[model samples]
Target: MKVKKQKRHRKSLTFYTACFGFRKPYKVLCDGTFVHHLVVNRITPADTALANILSATVKLYTTRCVLVELKRLGKSYSEAL
Candidate 1:
């Protein structure tokens, strides 16, 4: 039997839309150098609810799952960076 050698790349690329994203409620970022949970708290019928969804988008973070390492923020969620 013969064994094959594994290959590795020096760099890789990914898009934020590929991971977590939304057209409304929120946009989840999964960047290695810069990542954050972006959301807009919109008031619903009687209370606030996440209008847009981004569950699968967050899946982009494999070994470095950003969701698991998320920290509750105190700044304005609507702030544009």
Candidate 2:
């Protein structure tokens, strides 16, 4: 008998942002994945847009959980930031 593994569902940051009611002068909670993209990937249009939006109207934050994950990702990844 074969048993299938179910995929875990995750909510998007936009969903949390809406739930938190962020409006003008927004505050964004950055996840490790977003940080990874920003650090490892070459600058793309999306990255530039994100940077511009953040610079213009948003404040970014991260949690201890994210820090822990980053640490787990190892020194090279952390140092890249």
Q: Could you say which candidate leads in lDDT?
A: 2
Q: Write the per-residue lDDT of candidate 1 for residues 1-81, one digit (tens) a residue.
A: 112211111011124335544233234334423333334423231111122222212222223343333333424321212
Q: Flag clash pairs in model 2.
A: none
Residues 24-49 of candidate 2: C-alpha lDDT, one tens digit per residue: 45555778887788667743444345
| TM per prediction | 0.17, 0.50
Give model 2 RMSD, 1 decimal. Answer: 10.3
